[model samples]
Target: MPFPFRGFFLAGLLTLLLISSVQAQSVPTVIGARATLEPWSDPIEALGTLRADESITLSATLTEIIAQINFSDGEQVEAGQLLIKLEDNEEQAQLRVAQAIRDERRNALNRASQLLERNLAPRAEVEDTQARLRQAEAEIQALQARLANYRLLAPFSGRVGFRNISTGALVTPGMALVTLDKLDIMKLDFAVPEVFLDVLEPGLILTATSAAFPGYTFQGEIATIGSRVDPISRSMNVRAELQNPEMRLRPGMLMEVVVRRRPRQTIVIPEAALIPEGERHFVLVIHEEEDNRIERRQVQIGQRRPGDVEVLEGINKGELVVSHGVQHSREGDNVQLLGIASDETSVRELLESRRGQGDS
Candidate 1:
């Protein structure tokens, strides 16, 4: 059955074994990113609410019929602008009567003074007439002061809200007529943990964002800090002022605030390199160990930004970390380094591009 046939079969079996061994020895390729040292500014994030710099609800002081309404709804008014006028018909008649009596008293006082100068009337009589004329003038002044209450004037310059009462409607004292708010500048109030009290100060730059306006950021500064921290919450209240020329931010709007206290230099790495398990984090670090092997090292992380995370410990500058194909890697496994990612933005873009491809 022959020696030549047996030799050919053995040679073919050896060739198949050699090919399988070569395929097993081939290294797995993976993308790696280096830890970089960059200038990072730590941000104190907090929730806040926006408020108008100045706000007031206008109301009447006296009960009377509204004779005239000068402003319309949502109107911008100047300071001391005449906003409403109440009917003052009776007050006007009373003022006229008081003026007429004052005129009569003045004529009597003049005659009495002339008589006294001619020695026909006593000095007491002239003094009494002068007193009567002064009393009449005082009465007229009091009446005029009372008439001022019938008119309501704007206390400040701002935009006015809608009024509930009409021109002829009778409004009582303390009834709300309209609301006025100065929206040129807005006040943002927020609370931060008491630990940040030392860094909190006026004029610290901050940025705020709201869900109402996506992708838009409003810049402001810390205007004031509360004097005392709340005993219950253990947080201090902070106020910031923002210029709202466009009036896009309204009062009572919820905002996400980020206060940039100062800049710091720290180690950062691409977020894709981080592997979180439970409460701990790990990364596959590629180093020269029998032809570039991966070492699973635990890492301590800090504040995170877009596409990058702060590496507080367990990693050093310029260390190569596996950014892609982590699932195919293990500790002490030989890997082929395809490319080193230097730019964090590019790494993020590459990850997103891959994710998009997978999704499709």
Candidate 2:
């Protein structure tokens, strides 16, 4: 071969190599992301009502005059705390008399027992004194129990409602004095369709929201499910226990409930990464190594959540998929990976974040 012709051949080979390199570099710049395992679930929505864990109406058990009011309206009280005291002067006097008589009877019984032991008194005399002592003790117990009936006490740790009577007010048995509610823990009652009866059970997690306190959510777990479903509505009553550390929730407030069921971890990708052809769906998956080429693979999808789609088949966890530029790429085509997408943010937001990082 001629030397000039050989030089031309070498130059032509160099030119081809340079052009190929440039074409490879210019292939498309698109956002790509790894298929990630995320929690997926079918959520059941319902409405619920809030109630205190314990609620009761505090009332007087005996007819008496209110001697003292120990608690104000809406006051927080501990278990067995005295809330109101009725006039107990008569009971107190009777109790004191019974106590004195009891002491006297006890001394007599002791003396009789000593005498009997020494053979100075008959055993029948000792038995009579013992019987008198027992009677005195029984009288004291009756008086003490009567005194307790005059006072209204909080049965549990709770907040008291409005006081219905004042000091020196005459009250009768079963007269409403006030209301009390234990607010540390709340009970939420909701109804769910009987169709979910198979999955409905205690210990399932649920969340609730109230229009009264917008943007705040309460977390709880199912505590009880009704054994019988309502025939007319075809729903079952469900009760949940919610923590009330701050006591912000009150009884009778309406709540919105969301019960999560069938939770599982599965491979998921951004909805934008999927390309639909009629009823079929496809995603351009990037090769793990060796090349930046993509494969347009058909995927079987399941339940869809906001911003994400579950890949039932044809995709594996940690495999990269084209998210932003699927319209410009083809199968087996090499492309530029602009950045990795995420379920936390959209592709455009990811680009903005990168631009911000570059500016910073």
Candidate 3:
């Protein structure tokens, strides 16, 4: 080989060795997370069924053919409105007899009083007449109550179910007349794992959607929580109230309930930066400013959100956290942020992105 060729080849060989040495000296890992202030309110999921706020089965007070069906089946009835009428002609006649008897007793009692005052009638006769008058009045009231019951009236305002008897069909007292339910407000009954029993409370906001309702969702709040946990199922029963002004929701509809807790500002750290030691949590945080440093921070955990855990203490917002190679890092060490190759935040972003796609 000529002198110039040998020189160039030797130079190239030296260059390759230098590059290899540089590559061997560096190690890179993905650093997880971006600094974010987490809001409180963790996401909770549970399954349940929709129920009516109020439900009742109606029965007749008298045994007779539904004489007159004033209100149609499945109609909304107001409180105390006449819903059905039994054969009340007999009741009306009975009421008239009672009234006449009462009137006669009253007049007889007045005459006996006047005759006693004149000393022509005994006081016993006047006392007996007074008792008869009171007895007659009580009989009148009884007949009036029976007469009123002959007509079935709505006990409360609600939507009526289908009628079992027609105008001419006979229905005995306490028979299945129909059902009345108040549906303006609906209830959702569900159970949550016993592990989460302490975190749940009344008035917690809940969002629910059902496959039957498609894209529509119902918003509600925890109305009641069971006092005791279910021993057999190891779950807690929770009830939520949702508005149904349009009356689109029905009883017994299945739905999923999402309970959201109260929101408060909290410090958050990426999951990759967290290290567990003896039931305690620690995070590797990068010290920013003069002479880059690293520290192992003991952090208290609170409500956890997606991809991150809320740090109740030991970390602040906007702090530089070392999420990569945290296991190998020690506290009070000189660390350069760029020296470690970072892929941690990107991995989380990628997983979240794919999750969004799957959900859609």
Candidate 4:
């Protein structure tokens, strides 16, 4: 072999080694998201039962036969609306006789007063006539009161339940005739641990969901907090009122309630960005100014929500952290930015969207 040819071969071999090293150091592509300031809240969950704002069972106070049924099953009625008419023929006839007697007594009293003024009647006679008129008036009032007991009127504006009696059906004292409920607003009764008593107060916002109404969230505010906590459960009762103008909510419906508390703005990042090693969490943050190099950082985490986590420390707003391709990333390694994730779109979704665009 010639000496010059040997030297050229050695140089070529060196050049190839350098090229391989450069290729090995090539930046790996990764999906990342910026730590952002977002509104965060602590949620306290509980179970509750729904009740009507006002509810009552209509009943008869006296034994009587129903003469007319003014409403049908499940009818909406206004306050003071006549709902049932009981047989009051005897009371009505007695009232007419009493009224006539009162009218006659009043005429006699007026004549006695006139005679007394003319000195033709004694003062005692006028006083006696006045007493009789008073007695007659009282009798008429008593008969009218009795008649009132025969008529069943709605005490409040609400929807009526199934009628228990029909025309000519006899009802005794305390007999339930129907049910009435004001469903414009619903009351929810729930309990939370006594530890949350400090935060439990009227006007705290809550959201409720019922199995009977899937995907429908009922919004309400706490109306009252019980004065005492339950000794056995170590929980306090809470009552919330929900607007139910459509009457979709009914009494005795079981519901799941979540009360939001301690809301604040905090730094947040995608949950996928977190790498767990025992009790410690780490994230690979991207530094754009330094050729997109990653920095491994130990982070303190607080509450975690779906798809996102609260970053208590070790990150700031606008700092990008690797969300996808985290397994392939390490500290001080250069990375190629695939895309940035936003609150509306997750890292995996964003990667898929980018892939779709490339395919198009």
- Cα lDDT tens digits, model 2, 149-180, are 88778889999988767788988888888999
lDDT of 1: 0.89
TM-score of 4: 0.84
Write the residue-wise lDDT of candidate 1 on 1-360 in tens digits.
599999999999999999988877666768888898998878999999999999988788889999999999888899899988999999999999999999999999899888988999999998888898999999999998889888878888888888777889988999988898988899999999999988888988899999999999999999999999999999999999999998787889999999988768899998988999998999999995557789999999998889899999999998889988788899988897666767444655666666787699
What candidate 4 gets wrong by more than 4 Å, as runs, is 1-26, 287-293, 332-334, 346-349
Q: What are the models' TM-scores?
A: 0.64, 0.85, 0.65, 0.84
RMSD of 4: 4.4
Candidate 1: list runs displaced more than 4 Å: 1-40, 106-130, 263-304, 307-360
Comparison by lDDT, 3 against 4, better one: 4
What TM-score quantifies how close candidate 3 is to the native fold? 0.65
Model 4, span 1-360: residue lDDT tens: 799999999999999999998876666879888899998879999999999999999899999899999998999999999999999998889999998999999999999999999999999999999999999989988888888899989999999998767798989999899999999999999999999988777888889999888999999989999999899999999999999988899999999999978778999998999999999999999999998999999999999988999999999999989988899888999898888878587666877887998799
Top of the candidates by TM-score? 2
Per-residue error (Å), model 1, residue 327? 15
lDDT score for residue 170 of model 4: 89
| lDDT by candidate, in order shown | 0.89, 0.89, 0.79, 0.91
